[model samples]
Target chain A: MNAEAAQPYRLVVVSGGTSDPSSTRMLADRIADRVASLAEARDEKVAVSVIDLRELANEIATALVSQLMGPKMTRAIELLGAADAIVASAPVYKAAPSGLFSSFFHVLDNDLLIAKPVVLAATAGTARHALVVDEQMRSLFAYLRTMTVPTSVFAATEDWNSRELGERIDRAAVELLLLVESGFAEKVRTESWKSYQHEYGSAGGTELDIDLSTDLMRLATGGSAAPRRKP
Target chain B: MQFGVFSVSDITRDPVSGTTPSEAERIDAIVKIAVKAEEVGLDVFAIGEHHNPPFFSSSPTTLLAHIAALTERLIVTTATTLITTNDPVRLAEEYAMLQHLSKGRMDLMLGRGNTAPVYPWFGQDIRQGLPLALENYNLLHRLWREDVVDWEGEFRTPLQGFTSTPRPLDDTPPFVWHGSIRTPEIAEQAAFYGNGFFANHIFWPSSHSKRLIDFYRRRFEHYGHGTQAQAVVGLGGQAYIAKRSQDAVKEFRPYFDEAPVYGNGPSMEEFTKGTPLTVGSPQEVIDKTLTFQETFGDYQRQLFLLDHAGMPLGMVLDQLELLGGEVVPVLRKELAARRDPGAAEAPTHASLVAAKYGDAPARQPRPNANRGDNVTGGSPYQDGDAQAEYPSLG
Candidate 1:
């Protein structure tokens, strides 16, 4: 929604940290602050919500094993669904982001995050895992078909004492804000929705791209339902 | 409305006993269960088709034919006869043969079975599942309706004047129900043909069913099949009942926790609340089932999964008894009480014959003595008075 018209932009932060005093959640909070300040600087209002996947670890495991999303997962999904921009941060595991983070997205409907601008960040113990955001998380978000901001912020133990971490965070947050302010996600949702598969049961716009003249649809509407795409 | 039981035919080990029923034992149990479906007051019995181990019913027609021969009243069907891998021509012939054998007491639900390896086993590509299903069903629709089908589609070889043998009984094909859980296009296809839409309602949430069923109903009305209320709908549910609800849960927990499809995913309570699986007394089952009608509107058929997760043969039979005697009779009356009078009855061969002929004599589809040229013959039969006109799209 256009902030000048009706509603402020929705920003969702997903933190995949497993422990207290988590550096992953700390990066997510900083990214959220940077994005909010950037949007405020541009005279645009934004509403931010944080989803701590650490709290939902058991639920995620159950959903993975069961193929059913319980109530907790559903709330997390809802927050993502309404997001104009996403700040996703996960602590590095092995050489990649946490499996808890990956599984949470797997449990989501495929079409949920298409073309949304996602700012990628990760907290690692050492600089050796610094490319976790670029090498792993970038392609992960790419699979969901989200537009990852060019500048991905990575926080390592040494980077916390350096100025580069704050600089990268500012760059990533500003890039996300630019995309959000330009309504890029909404544009993709509206303009290219037909290019994606329309899941029937999901709540969204249904009137835009349903081709009524297709044989099945023609049979469905009995030749009387109004023709879509008159031109 | 018709109410019945459908099984996946999984030969699972009893989680409590660690004893897996032998294939022979499971097979015998399934046949007995089907027979018991009719022995009680149930109206339908559907068996699933699986080519792999752990699931035994490979030839549904053979099994259904056996059940049909054994029972006089019950409607025998497939939970889903795979539409993607199986040839449509064979489908037409085999189902017609089943119809003849059953004496017009069979119908089948079609699905794009998600078992990936089965696709390659049958020489089909899993990636083309949707298109294969669509094109194959388009041809199958023709094979049953048209006397001579000249067909070409993306997945299969072109047919040159293929005449699928043993025409459907009464010159009216068995009614079909399309079973879908998530795909909207499948619901669209079911509505397109004015066929029944069966939601696999046990695994998924009611919101999912509500959306798909409501979509089908609206499209059914749009397609001039009927008002949204008059559209034919079938739902799959699961219930385990005892005299007391707690006993039902205690008895069913092990089976529920270890079953292949949904085991180890959600707690029984979470699953019960999220989806349609109910473990309770007869009264509780009845109460939960009534909510289905309230949610999806008055539907035409309700099929429950009674025998899965290696519940003992004795327990399965006992569950069927409760379902048929205690649960279904009440559901039949309660579902009927609020149903719109003008809504279509569950379609059967006899009902379809009545629909095709009204009071007139239904066509017998007599065969010619020896017709060599099925391609050029104006009518392929000798007593070719009433060759029904079919859509020539395929």
Candidate 2:
């Protein structure tokens, strides 16, 4: 076991459902519960935290327009920054994930979730939109460089009652549990963080490392950007 | 501490009046505004540069030189002169002339402009903005200090034995303040040169500005310029003050709602709470401005964004009265009392000249007769060392 394996794994759930008792949040919670019980069966502890996008709807819109982070939005970023793994669920509108879900991720720093494990799940009214999870949502997390599990959970009205839905959730839960147990995210951050591109104050304001030895930094300190002339 | 007012030179429509001022009218009004700033005893008046319509002051030095001629004891400056697109050679020449015209009563802050299209208009790529700003400033720094420069850089053509005319007022370069919202490299550049770092403390939360300012202070000390406490810092503030807090809020709400940069976004109350914008009575403005010292340490200058959002000249003049007459006097006393003993004073022409030449006379550079070629040759100035070597043309 690694140093991180001694502590309870922190699993964060982000739900982009808009209504009370939303199916999107329910799907996320079901996956989170399955992951928790699966970890417990292996004699490991799991701590789960939920980020309801409905609560942050206004804040997300405000951030989209003004680049200002509200208190709730700031807290949500803090939780995600500390999370070991994430379960992201959204209600499909038209043929894609809800704007609230996409906007929330859009406001996050590009490097915030580097190498972090995630379980992408989505709910739609029809089976026709089932591919939204893998096609659209996965690409967004991919751009963020998250380590999304191979098994993505998708639920339509019909699938919610089908037994295979639960089986897929179980498969995703175990995949995430194994990834979290391996400490891939922690290792990448600890060992290879400098290899990734980062902006100053990015990664939820935690990426503050500045490399002062670059060519631009040399120019900043009065050295010329041009090649030195031969004597 | 120095107290001043800065404008973005935005010709916004008055949401309350439902009218927009003509560019000519706004231009005339800004001159009146700067005159009133000094009339009411404010120390500085700054104007911003923009190339687009609905923004008038594309030529900051032209406008500032006029303002300096109109008012006495009021230092005129740019809120930010673009360092990315404008050639460093032109900036060195024009600002030196302005320094001479104003008799060392002018200084400027540098910023990479936000408008992307403006870059291509001047044969630049916005993607290269940061490097361009850093490199151009590197050249501009040499032009004012060194009489003859032989330079090569990435963005601009190389300079050979080039001398920028007018050489700065009494051989003193106008003090510079680097304005940045988030870029640490900008702060590093500012600290590397011992220049002031000005945070546009109006748009973002104070924490953002605090992080940048703290980094600047550390690097300033690292560069051995001074102790962290003695690094010069400037903050931008926004306020709408009245006899009562409620009246202030009521009067400013329409303008705040329809203003261009942040309109249709956060509510006035929310923005006021989140950023350094204060809409309250004179005492409240004074109280909130004082907290800036606590947050960023004792700093040198505080500039307020007073005349934007289509605010009429009459209303802006009233704000200047409440600011210069009521708010600034109290703030001056309070900030002076709270300042750290080791903190540096705001840079001025007299002080910089005194620092450069303690008892000796300042160097007055007189150019040798032109050789008709572009080259000024080595020892271009009469006072320059004659023994300096140059390749023989033989």
Candidate 3:
């Protein structure tokens, strides 16, 4: 079933961090809940799937590089690929983002994110590393050609206790909802230097769109999705 | 050159005055510190993976995928992705998807985790942990490079025929840096594959890390990756910098004394004297870190455990500023001066993957060979002729 069957807007929550009842995961939940609530308020049907990467870490990792997808991860990957918008949250590790989270992204294809919209948020102590959302996370979004909502919410530990957090999260969620309703707020058009066709008359460009749905069938039969890149 | 910050995921009491931040507060604090690392300009950001209590992240990949949608230029990597317990097949696919999501800004370091009990919980025996890592990684390597594989291995069931999904963006697998502290076996594994070797050299002095890295470099050459100098190496370190050395030590002492990992052993002076830990001025850190090369020879990546020791997020950010503004430029210059003209510069995600499994450069595959049977006689089975059934072993 597609999102249209379940709901028009789906919120996919990515909770990244170790399993110590992290505030980062809480932050992810808060944003997700807020988004769900907002969707309900607007009388819009929305589906929410919380993928605690910790639970599926083993299978997901094994499935990714080897192209072995368990039923659960396959469902999760499909949701992630088809989601209209996403709210991603992680606790900062070191001065950047968590390595576990990076590992998860490493297995994804750049084409999966083309023209998708995303909302980025992070949790940290004090106000020291708040800018990581823009400096680090947003940069990755830009590279993947995803449309990131402008207003990101970065909450410090102190901000959590403050009443302002709910309002802030709600505001970010509302902004994302607005974008989801409106479609791409900013149109990003990459400057293509050249375009051509292969000897077999296959149209190719710096970025080309092929029917992966058919490729998926071939992969199912061959039991492999490995690219034909020579080592 | 490498720059990164790692988190300990702890909320500790201020040793001077018992003030323990709630777990919630500690987690939020870590998030901010990571964002700040990027703002100040750092190359890579890595987070540790732990399954037990006190360590918040059991799912580093999910977190990383989220972070991938967040960052731009910074290369995201794991300080340690547990290779012992985690299934290599999943590791392969998840990271490939991440590479796609991040637009090629992803890579990781493989390590056998510190904890022991984590093994059995995952239905694995800690006794066979090293074997699992070795065998699993070998499979993972093949999964990334090969399009279709008929693989059978000890740990996982046989794959009559298999291909991972969500093909890699650049058709390149993420670069891997095998991280180890004292294990020469891990070094050998890394060297055998021509992968980078990282010494999370926090506990030991440069001399100790040097022995392991040298072993890896030598073995790497033996395996035909390149010369010893051409082998990629990364080091892990710890530091707390203040303008004044006295103040730096004074402020960090309590946390050091109470840290779950470091609090138990040697006296502060003794620990500082022998280990890579440095609690002093920015200049002192630079001086000590630069000496790493003298001891270990030319290295590639350098990451520090700054967010650990239960230090507050505010103080950690201050350290990052100094690191970005004061430390990085000087270290870059000094390392550049000392670089071996013959040795390749440190490999970034782009460089490493290209060197390993990049798109076919000269020997390109013929375009429509698989489409028609005219050339090599296509498989007897057409696209949908049958399910391509494999007989049951039982």
Candidate 4:
């Protein structure tokens, strides 16, 4: 058996929906379910964990203002850090993703989601926000350096009942499954994590490597900025 | 352990009184507060450096010098002198002058000031803050120790043959504590030089400070300063004390609600729980503080943020009374008992002088007669190396 068949992939679903029975969360759950079923069909397992952003609203706001991560926020970060793949869903508001969705990612360490496989999905009251997923949200995942699937899922009130949305979800789920099976995130993290810029405690406080060979580190050690000029 | 108060030097309006103290009034009030710190048997009084309004201490040394002359035992220092914006040459000269005026009762903490606008006002870029701070401090380090420095650095003009005059009091550079919230480079810089690492532990959780402190300690040991247990560390905390916990909470709530930085974000109870803020009785404050030692191992200094958030002078004085009378005494005794045998002591000028010059007299730099050229020819001071050479312009 291959490495993917021997161990379960940890898939984390982040829903930025505020209501109890949020359609945004429903879209994410649908995508997550599809991913798990697809993995199981290949004799692979997926452990799905949901991070309901509404539950962490206060923590997110507190973190943005004070840089103090509440327990719930810390737990969410822990979930994201270990996630092999992610299903990030947000509610579209004012031609953009919800402020809560954007703010949650804003407080995260830049290096936390690097090289992770992600499936971008969004829900809105009207079908006009269908482009919110690829147009607005994809750039955010790109900035985080996540490998987003070629197919993105978007569900408006009308599309929720349509067959096309289901097809899109399946296409995205297969893409995510293949990426996870490839172990791309793990390979990048283990092999090339140092190629990315990282602060001292970035990557959910796990990026603790200190490179003492840089010009800044040299200056930090009482050496001049230009190494060649030093006698 | 050493206990003291450090002010951000904010001239914030009193939320209860609904009145802001003018810069003149706040300036006078800080001097009184520093004097009161000594009167209440506190060890250190540090003021922050700010170049903007709503804060008065643009020149910390000027205020600290007067405070030092007023109080005998109190050590006047900075919450942080700006290492990013200020010229390192001026810092070396001005602080050396402060060290002289205070008669060896001063030390300063260095930090990169976070205000973005303040950087451009001083001909600096905020993007270059870390390198600027690191490079500036490297120059300042040599300026104080070496009588005539032949230095070149990235951020500032190269010094061909420059002397930061009024040489350090007793020829011993004042002890420096590098204060940082999250930057490990600052901690590494401190460790590489065997300087003290201070964590401004007021805003964040203990776990965050613990990570940096742990890194600093490990790196301090790696640099062979001493064992991890012997690394000099300082922590900043926030507290408000009354006889009753409820009363303390009630009194500090309004100020805590409207205070700068963290105000309006989290409730007082949440903040006190999440951070090192302790709004309770003196015993409760002492218990919370003792946990810092448990969390960070043996630390040297613990400075409290008691006077900020527009707390009236009388209220701040009352807080100090409780702190000096009930809290710090017990904390001192407890921390002393629990201190690791290998832990370093809180740095003081006298101790630094003693370390630099055992039983011998400390060197007092006297300048040679001027050559009427604006630059000292070979060595600036009479006792410096006479054979030292500098390239001539002619």
Give lDDT: candidate 1, residue B2.
Answer: 95
Compared with the true structure, model 2 gives a TM-score of: 0.97
Lowest lDDT block of 10, candidate 2 chain B: B385-394
Which is the leading candidate under lDDT?
A: 2
Q: Rank the candidates by DockQ, best first.
A: 4, 2, 1, 3
Q: Is the docking of candidate 1 incorrect, acceptable, medium or high quality?
A: acceptable
Interface RMSDs of all predictions?
5.0, 1.2, 20.4, 1.2
lDDT of 4 by residue, B152-271 (tens): 777778787788787899999999999998888899999999999999998888988899899999999999989999899999999999999999999999999999999989878779
Measured against the true two-chain complex, the DockQ scores of the candidates, in the order shown, are 0.35, 0.69, 0.01, 0.75
Model 1, range B278-353, lDDT digits (tens) per residue? Answer: 8999999999999998888888899999899989999999998899889988998888898878778888888899
CAPRI tier for the interface of model 4: medium
Put down candidate 2 lDDT per residue, B90-164, tens digits, no spaces. Answer: 999999999999999999999997778899999999999999999999999989988888787889898777788
- In model 4, which runs have C-alpha deviations exceeding 4 angstroms? A228-231, B386-388, B392-394
Lowest summed lDDT across 10 adjacent residues in model 4 chain A is found at A222-231
By summed lDDT, which 10 consecutive residues of candidate 4 chain B come out lowest? B385-394
Weakest lDDT window of 10 consecutive positions for candidate 1 chain B: B382-391
> Candidate 3, which CAPRI tier?
incorrect
